[model samples]
Each structure stands twice: as structure tokens, then as C-alpha cells.
Target: MPDSAGILPLPLFSSSLKRDTSRPVMLIGFQHQGNLGLGYLASTLREHGYSVLTCDFEAETSEIIESARQSKPMIVGFSLIFQFYIRKFDALMQALRAAGVDCHFTIGGHFPSLSHEETLRMLPELDSVVRFEGEMTLLELADVIGTGRDWHDLQGIAYRGTTGVVTNPMRSLVDDLDSLPYPERNFEPEKALGRKALPLLASRGCARTCSFCSIQTFYRTAPGKIVRTRKPAKVIEEMQAMHEERGISIFLFQDDDFPLFGPVWRRWAYDFVDCMHRSGLAQRVIWKINCRADAVEPEIFTAMRDAGLYLVYMGLESGNEEGLKTLHKQVSVEQNIRAVEMLKQVGLLFEFGFMMFDPGSTLESIKQNLRFLRTILNDGCAAAVFCRMLPYDGTPIKDELERAGRLLGDVCAPSYDFLDPRVSKMYNSLSQIVDVWGWIHGYRALSPQLNWAWNEVAIMERLYPGIDGLEEYRRRLAAVTKKSNDVLFSVMDNLLEVAEFDAAERWDNARLDALRREFLEELLRERDAFVEHNQSTMLRVLRAQPVQEAASA
Candidate 1:
């Protein structure tokens, strides 16, 4: 057994219920984007000889009811990763129950894993809660249920007992990730940004414990190794299978911190490149990954690019040094800049997670963050819009706020007010404008054009290499992207300036509505010009003819 030093212990019991393995199991998730956790769980259950069916959160109420009625599962497991979805999950459960498709309901995922008892109390319809690292624990539970045995002795589970709620000790982490089967992706055809895509995980667990993130708490409380990776050859073999079966060329590495975790990652990176080359999949596919700013080594990234890494996502979090420290980001602003520069040097496109507001943010710090965003925007990086830090349950930040008596609202969806009310007011005001202009207008309307342009460029680079005008086409697309981002930042700056001055007066509902309308009209006009220019450029690229051999005549 690994160290259980600071972890809490739970009551254990012996099961009295009989197991029924022949009954089907159904997994439900709000994962239109793709739920790797659910996928892994389904695969593991299937390996243990259980019939499984899945219902995405996107399914209509009628469809979900029909699926449950048809499957008549013995277990209906709900994956509740985010706390914000509790209300939705509750409504869905009520609907399913009303539909008269009764079964033993269990909930798991990040939120439920941490607050299992609270979740059970909130939704009594759920019969049990699967705790951390559920693969083996769930498998064992299935076996016990199959044999009509007692589940009280099972580790890593919290279930309603005849007396009260009974909890069990945590399970050990899976040291060898290769021991698990690849996630079941055949349930539905997956797409990302309107293109064929597959979600892949190279590793698990993050090294850094950010105050605003719950991943640290999730893994820290579990036993055994915190981070585990599959063999590079195994990873490639899975990707190769996906390529052959689904023709999926675009892959999204869903690892929390893709390139961190010490020398193990360094070795994995090298071996991954080698395996890709040996397997000959490197030239046929392009992929994206997420990592920290401090992990952006030029040499490593260059090798990654050579192995088909075209895009990267970094959690810069905050540009302000103080804000960075508050979030326990550890890395300095200089490191963030250096990371961005390294990606630029390696010719990789990147998007960033930037937090403009935090619990202790002041007006000056917000300005610093704005300046930081402008610097990155000017450098041709796409910012993932500006937002305040959310203090999630089980995160250190949430605990700190709760201890300090600053936490407010529901535990499932807690809200924190800023220390400086003016900063809060500014955020609220600017967020209103940003919601309409930046999010609805800019990102929804204009960002897709840029992504489509990049997709075209990638296709041309791979399919028609050495073709004339490729470089020119790339330059044109980059120019358009930069221009659109510039406009986005300008709008943010303008809103911030307005908020800094006449915040109370300009924040009136009627005035804000007028301002939103005006900004929307202006943004649409500017977005149209950029989209037209990009579409024309793409048409030219598509129309360009390849060099023809001399005629035989």
C-alpha cells in the first residue's frame, strides 16, 4: 500500500446484495466534446464481461429514456466532472426516474469524486458514488454485484447503506497505464471544430498543484504514483489504429500537463518521436497538446514539431506576477514570455488560458493583465478570452476562501466577490460587453474563419508540398488572424477604459445595451471584411493547379 498519511479514512462494510453481471450497464456523460474518463470506464467494464451502453448529454430526453428502457441496465453511472452541471444532472435523473426506467444509479468524475457524500445528499436518487481512480474499484464492484455479494468491503466507493452512508478506503493508482484498454470511441463519431478528431491521453496527473485547480486534490488523495504514462509504442499503436479505422488525422492530447513530470516526460518525448518515425504516422497526421509555460523548451518543441505537433495550448493563467503567485503558478512573467517566444521560434501556433481577474485582484493588477494580453496578442497568439478566476470545490483556493469566510453561494457552484468592489464592478461591466462582442460575435463568428483558414493551410502543406504560393497563403492567413485578434484586444481595451472611468454611469442597463448593440454592429462589419479576404485567399489556394508534365505530343 502506498502512503495514506494525510488522507481521511472511510467506514467499510460487507456486501449482502447479490451480483447480477448479465444485466447491462449504461454510462452517461455531458461529453459532446469527448469524455475520456467515461470512455475508459466503459472499456474496463466491457473487459470484465459487462454489456455496456452510453448516452451522451446531448441526447434528447426521450432518447435517453428510450435508451434506458431498452438497455434495462443494472447500473446507470453518471460522470459528473464539473460542479456547474449538478443542476442539469439532477434534472436528467428526475426525468429518467419519471420515465420508469429504474436501476441502481451511481455517480463519479472530478466533482463527485471529491464531494461524494455531499453529492449523494443532494441527489438521493443516486445509489452510490465511485471515488478516486475508479477503474479497478468499479470492476470489483461489478463482480460483487454479479455474484450477489456484499459491496461494503469494496474500496474507493461511497454508497447508501441500510444504516447510513458507507464509505471505503481509496484504491491504489494504476501504475502501468498500458494495463488498461484504449477508451471505447466507437460509440459515436467524434469531431472537433467541425473536423474529424480523436482525443488521446499520453499521461495522467499534473505535477503542479495550482490553487484554482482540483486535479491536484483528486490525485494527491489517491494512493501510488501520481503520474503514469503508457509506452510510446503503445500510444502510437492506438493512434495508428484510429487512423486506419476512422481516418482521423487530427488528434487532441487530453493530458492535463502534456510535457511536464520530470525526466520521464523527456524520455517519453524522444521515444514518441522515434516511434512515430518508425511507425510512419508522423508524416500523415497533425496534432495539438496542452502544457505549462515553464515546460516550453525550444529543443523539445522543435523535435515535437518535426513529429507533427502543429498547435499548443498553454495555461499562462495570469500575466501579473502577483496574480501568478496568488494562483500558485510558480512561473514568472519572464518565463511565460520565453515560452511563447520559443513556440514562435519553433513555428508553432498557440492559444492561451489567461485570467484577468482573481480573488484579490485590484484595478492596477487588472491593468497589468490587460497589458500582458496586448503583448501576447501583438505577438500573434490567440487569447482564450478574458475571464475571472473560478474557485472550484476541492481546490486550495476554494478552501482558503471558505476558511477566510469569503466564500459565498452554493457549495456545488460557489461564488466569490472581489476584495475591491470597484474591480468587481469593472469586471461585471466589461464582461457584459465582452459577452456580446467578444464571445458571441468575435469568437463564435470570426474565430471559426481563422481556424478554417489554418485547416486549409495544413491540408495544403501536407497534400501539396513544394507547391507555389503556399508560403504566401500561410502569410495571408497569419495576417488575417493577427488583425482579428488586434480588433478583439482593442475592443477589450476600450471596454476596460470605459469601466475604469464612468463605470457606475455607463453600466446602466439601457446604456450597456446600447453599447452592446453598437459594438456588435462594428464587430460584424470588421469580421465580414476579414472573412471575405480569407475566403478569397483560400479559394485561390484551392484553385491553384499543380505543375503538369510536358505533353507527349
Candidate 2:
């Protein structure tokens, strides 16, 4: 643990009150596809007569310092969602302080909320941490700071005092979500991937308590309802406003589980479609959502598609029954398969979140996952990638691993090696390949190509729907993408098998490196071919369209 003695003194809350209430309350967050958490907080703060400024993760340290200096916020709230970004946040805060930008600093979101004590100990620059749901908590804290009132008694906050760290009692969750203000719309039209996309949250919290998920733990610790949703009318109102005001034609629902609220979901779905139809935004704006496997139903998905649902991202987690049980997924492999079939039946594009390795993973479990991926791939379901299950802080898996002495690394980045040597070796090999070929190449190199294609498809669908061969072009591009992804996964599986055998025979590093490079080259070639084919086809489709349709599209 680092010493906090040399940390800078806390900014005077009294001085902050002298500033105009209209001065923005700056909130910082990571560069995710969309950060609705900060958006919600910003909107809530605005409702309470506090102005807000949101700085994304991509903002350089110098840019942040300049922004803060200009905004002159009384308090700056940092959204510490991922542990991996804590170090970056720490550096940014240090830079801000060194630059003489004095302000009260607070941190919130999953990481800080879950491990507030550790966070305070690690980051001395932060004044306090807002736990669980932050809307009301942050509003109250700002009021306290503005009025120079004692903040120690505030619930849902952990702060340092003369007596040391003081953690207040937990705050109750907001019961009527409809009462809350809609999240602020801060979308940059030019920066959006050719289509102005807005992230909307229909619900908060998940019904299932997966052992490896921090969200489940965060909600469990907070009082009140586990899963709360806004009224369908309110949801539609927000969407309509964005579409009509900002020309946002795409909506991405950032819900943990889109349709897992049981009977409430069916009614909500129907009402949502009804509202969309009434508002006429359904036909104008296409959307994507995240949900669980068991929540899938053919009828519901078909209705959603008709209401302009464009994509569905499902958390399949694992295919092996034992792996599912270990993770407490509460859904069977059959359920996952059924969900895929439902999406396919509805002709909806989809993606999956799969875990190929976990704490107790063995070669047999990995093999099962491979078979599962193969099944989905051959069925032409969607692009699926497998990752190792990370035992996030405050999760059941983290607690269990710590108790068993299997957990490694500090609280910020908890990791563990597999008990099975074969699994460990295979993972090491596959990870190397993924680092070079799958992760970096796929996200950095191939993502733009895919996003461009997606944007073109959305444009054609919206502006020139009656144009010839547009649907066929979409289908062909999707097929190429699916095939390309399948080949990548197949190569990964082969590399894992080869690594497992090589480990058993104690193969030399030179031999292993050579094999890895060979596989990587093959993957790169396959990826390039697919990207080129998609790009060429997209260009052809646009060029072949009638001049008026192309101009409009």
C-alpha cells in the first residue's frame, strides 16, 4: 500500500459555494462505446440546479486540466468503473493537482463503490467515494459541499475524516425510476460511427446473481428494488426527443439484462412497441440491446425487430453445464441454444459474451467451450469471442478465490492461474495469439471496417429502403463476417490443442513461437480478405443504387 502523508490538502468546500451554481460539475469517465452512467448522473445533477461537464476517457491529461480550470467546478466526480483504468485515473488526478487546479475530488461507479476503502487508500487525491446508485448521493454531496455542511453523515458515501476513513450507512435505491430525469444527451454527431447513436437505459440492475459480476454485488448491497425500469412512455419520450432534436437514428440500450424482468418485460415490450408506433420513432430509429439467454422468446424478439431492433448482444457466459453452475448463471446450455435459435428465427443480427476459461477451468471444459463455439459458428448465429472470466472485486468468485488462496494481483487487477497445468499452458498460448491477432487486430484494425459497413447498412435501410439489392448486400456482408469470425475461432482452437500437446512434450520456446507466428499470419490473411470483400461489396452496392437513392443514402 502507498503512503498518503504527502497527498495534497483537500480543497475548501466553502470557497466553492461562492462560485455561481451554474458552474458545471465536471464528471470524468472512460472511453467506452457509450457511458450512460455519467450521463445519468449529469442529468440528475442538472435537475437539482447544478450544471455538469462530462470528460471522456480519451481526453488527454492536459485537456482535462484545461477543462477543469475553465469550468472551475467545486467538485469533480470521477467514474471509476473498471479497475484497469484506476492507474490512469490516478495519474490524471495527480496531473490536475500539479497544474494547480484546485477542486474537491470524488470517485464513484462499480470499482470505487465496491472497494471504497482500497480506493481511498490507493488514491489519496480523491476526497470521497459515492457508493451504489449515485444520482441522489451525488446531489446531496454537492449540496453539502456548497453549504459547507458536515458530509460525514451522508449515506452511500465513504470519506476520510480526522478520525480516519468513515463509511456511512448504505442509501436506498430509487424506487420509481420514472421520477428520475432522463440521461443527458451528449452524443457527438461527427464522432459517431457515421450514424448518430444514443445510448439509452431501459432498466438498471440484473435479476440473476452471476458470481463473477460486480453489478449483482453492487445492487445486492444497496437497499430497495433489485431491478428497476422506467415507464415505457418515459423511455419513448426520451428516444423521441433524441431522434427529433439531434437526428440520432440509432439507439443502443445499455441495460445489463434487457428482458429479464419476468412478466413485467412482456408488458413493457408491448407498451414499448405501442409507444414507438404512436410516436413514429420506431420506424425512424434502429436500436440494439443487451440481454440474457433465458430472456429470449421468438414472439418478443420478432415484435422488437418490427419495432426497429437492429442487434442483440447476449451474455452466454459458458456452454459447459459445470461452468454454468460454477458461475451461477442460472441458465442451462439448452437455454443458450434456444436463445440463438430465437434470434436467428427473427432474422436479427446478434453477438455473444462467452467465457472459455475460468478459475477451475480444465482442458475438458475448454474443449466443451470450443464445441459450443463451433456449433454457434456453423449455425451462422453471429460473431462470438471467448474470454477468461475475470474475478472482479466484490464478486462471489473473487471472495471464493481469495479464501482458497487462488487469487493473484492486487485488488485493482485480480487474476488467477488455472489449477490444471494443461489448461494454463493452453491459455498462455491462446492468449498470445489473441493479443496479436484477435484483440488488437480485431478491435483496432477491423472494427472501423465493420462500423463503416454497419453505418452504410443503417443509412440504406433508413433512407433508401426500397432500393434494389440492399438487403442482399447486407446478407452477403454478414455471411462474410460470420465466416471470417468462425475461421479465427477455429484457428484459436487448433493453436490451443497444439499448445496443450507441446506443453506435455516440453517443447522449446523457439518451436512454439514459430507455430504462433504461423497461425497469426493465417488469421491476419483471413481477416484482411473478409474486410476487403465487405468494403468492396459496400462500395458496389452504393454505386449500383439509383443516383437519387445513392445521393439520399
Candidate 3:
């Protein structure tokens, strides 16, 4: 039953706000990596009979303005995913206004909702900021705009009144996950290997309050249930529909905590596994999920693997006890190691989020983090990757840094100085080396390409099993990965030695540059060889398979 807003009685949208039903709403947001934020808002509006248009936030300003002109929507919404991109949004919106594409402009997401006044100050052209849980609120805003009524008193919104910005009372979070319509797929589905891939959500919100993460803060500040999950049957139904109707074989579970954390959620996981087996979808498709390190128990993960769980992404954010405590991760260093071991034992392909540098970082912590990465990745189980943590808006870490007077940089790119200055210099050198070889320009870089190629081989082995030379290919891929990891470890170790000795002036830039180039050349050559030989072979097997058949079939 919907409230007076003609949508579910979720927080934000009011019953008094009614749309014309025929008015078109336009949304502009980052579409990369299956952005379901805008997808849900678009779907909700469509459910209530309002036409919707979507434009990628990365599109050129002229292209976006052209889209607005062509669509002529009653209201144009912007999905601001990060506060760092505020300047980009400002310039684009300012351009749109100058071009006289004068539909109502609204922005929504973590930064805007948490700091609405600051957002308004940053992007003055925006008419309203749709605070947390925006489905109903956006629809109601559309309805009011369509009917030419005053939207000043709308709840779950912040707008500039005659005097200043007025924020309406916060709305309750949507209590039920199953009531909402499936998000509209406004873009082409992504692919894993050669199989069609899509991201699905079984739940919304996270229970943990990690200081560096905003997910908890985003859901906690809102009024309703914090971590609502759909029933197992409902989740399976969507998976089945996608598998049967859309030829999707890869399911990427985008849940913040993947509903697999504790005893209560373990029961939910078992039920979900049971449903997967009963529906026979488990045999046909492979899926992945993101969960906390503590959630990775051997028994339940084994069951999940049997039910088509292919990968697990854990937020193993830090390596040492002090680092974990600083980030408020709650889980210990031993727990993190145990979880990784458990995943390996269950035969799950695992990836992790590791922060090698943070405000609390010291020389000893840096050494410990590096050692941890080598311990995990020396065997070529997963690619070695690490990065510095940024203090994004709405996170407790950022607030803490501000209070400590340690925060540097602006909202566009929030950063902080490490407690030890030498650690900063070491990090900078490490960054320079990795940026040259690992992750600068995406596929053209070494580490990312290596990871992608490794993932492809893993997926191929699982999807099209018994392909000739597959094991040999896997062995060779592991060799390539190990070689690259060794070089990374070596380079970082040298930089750490330099930092330890305070040899700042004699940095040996030429030697490091040569090493980077030589390693990159070798890595790319190996990667290209693997792709050339194996990719087409796997594709041929895929092409030979019958349509709508199980992977093992």
C-alpha cells in the first residue's frame, strides 16, 4: 500500500506532493560500475507513470546541455556520488543554466545529504538537495514541479528560501526492500570474461560504523531500519529473471555488508543458499559479494560456493592492530588473516581493500602493511594492491581530522598529513613508482591489467571448465603475477630503506624509472600473450555451448 505520495511510504516523499504523471524527469550521474543510486530513483519515477531520462555524469558539458535541451524534462536531477567532484558539477550546472536549460536542478548522494548547506554553497545553481533515501522525495518533487505548486515545504529536501537554506524534516528510511521496483538498466550490462555481468543488491545499509566509511553514517542518520534485506525468495526471483530473460551469468552482489556478517545473517545466507539450489540457478550462474572480514567462516562460505558463489571482496582495510583501531574496523589483524585463510580454504576467489597509508600511519606500520601484502599475494592468490585513504565528507575520520587540525586539502580532494613526515615522503615515492607501472591510466597500466587478466583466466576456468591447456595457462598466469608482485615488493622495500636512512637528496630517480619501464614492458608482454592465446579459446567454448544451459552442462 502506497502513502498519499502514490509511492511507498518511505522517508522523504510526502503524500501531499502529487506529480502530473505525464511530466518527464531527467537524471545525470556516473553510470560506471553499475550505479544503482540513480537507477532506483529513475525506476521509482517510472513506476508512478512519470517518464525518465538518464545521462552519464561523465558526459561532456555540451553533451549534457544538449541532452537537457532535447529531453525538455520538468526536473533534472544530478547524482553527486562524491564531494570531490563538486567543482565539476558546479561548472557543468553553471553551463546548463547559462544555456537556458532552466528546468529545476536537484542533487542527491552522501555528501549533499550530509552537508546540504555546504553543498548549496558549493553548487549554488542547484535548486534542491534531495537528502538521504531519495526515491519518494524525488518523485514528490517531480509531482510538485509537474503541477506548478510550491515545493518550498517539501520534506527530505533542502532549498534556498528567501532568507537562507531551509532543510525539511528528515524522512524515515524505507522499511521493506522487496516493495521497491527493480532498478531500471539504463545502460548496457557489463561483462566478466565473455559472460554477461550485472550487479544486484540483496540488502541496503551497513551495520558497522567504520570511521573511514560513510555507509553507516548515511544510513544511521536516516530515520528507518538501517540494514533491511530482501527475502531469499525475492532475491532468487530477480536472479532467475536476469539469468533466464537477460542472459546474465555473472551476479555481482553490491550490498554494503552482503547480509553475511553474523549468526542472524548466517541464517539468512543459508536460506539464500537453499533457495539458490532449489531454483537450479546456482548451477547456471556464478555470483560475488562484499562482506566484512569477520563474516568469512569456512562452513557457510563452503555452502555458498556450492550455491554458485564465485568471489568474495572483503574490506581488509588495514594490516596492523593500531591501523585497524584507528580506522574503527573492530576486527583484529588475526581475524583478517583468518578470514583470508577461510576464503582460500573454501575455494573462493578473493579480493581485498587495503589502505597502506593513513593519517595514523608510521614507518613501522608501513613496513607491516607491506609485509602483509606480500604474505597474502606472494602465492599469486590475488593481485597485490594498496592505496592511501582519503577523508571524504560525512565520515567520522574526516571530522576527527578537522578537530585535530591535521586535515589538509579542500572538499574537492580531501587529504591529510601523516604523523611521521618521513612516512609521507616514502608514500610519495611509492606512489610515483606504482603510478608509473600499476594504476595510472587503467588498462594501459601494469598492475590493473595483470589483475584483469588473472580474473579472466579464473572466470574462464569456472565458466568453461575442461578447456584444453587451461591448467597450464593458469600456472603461467600465476607465474606472471608472482613476478610482478616481486618487483612491486622490491621497489617499495628500496624506498622504505631510503626513507629510513633519510637519504632524501640521493633518491636515484633514474634507476627507479628504468626499473618501472623494464617491469612494465615484461608485464604487458606476458599479459598480451595470455589474452591472445586463451581469450579466443574460451570464447570458442562459450559459442559452442547451448543457449540457456548450465555452466557445467
**Best TM-score among the predictions, by candidate number:** 3
The digit string of per-residue lDDT tens for model 1 on 108-164 reads 888888887788888878878988878887777766665566667778899877887
lDDT of each: 0.73, 0.74, 0.82
* 321-348: candidate 3 lDDT, tens digit per residue: 8999999999998899999988877778
Instruction: Give the winner by TM-score: 1 or 2.
Output: 1
| Root-mean-square deviation of every model | 7.6, 7.1, 3.7
lDDT of 2 by residue, 350-377 (tens): 7778888898787788788888877776
Q: What TM-score fits each model?
A: 0.85, 0.84, 0.92
Judge candidate 3 against the unseen true structure and give its global Cα lDDT, from 0 to 1.
Answer: 0.82
- TM-score: which is higher, 2 or 3? 3
The alpha-carbon lDDT assigned to residue 527 of candidate 3 equals: 57
Candidate 2 collision pairs: none
Runs in model 3 with CA error above 4 Å?
1-18, 436-443, 503-540, 544-553
Ranking by TM-score: 3, 1, 2
Candidate 1 TM-score over all chains jointly: 0.85
Relative to the true structure, candidate 3 has a C-alpha RMSD (angstroms) of 3.7
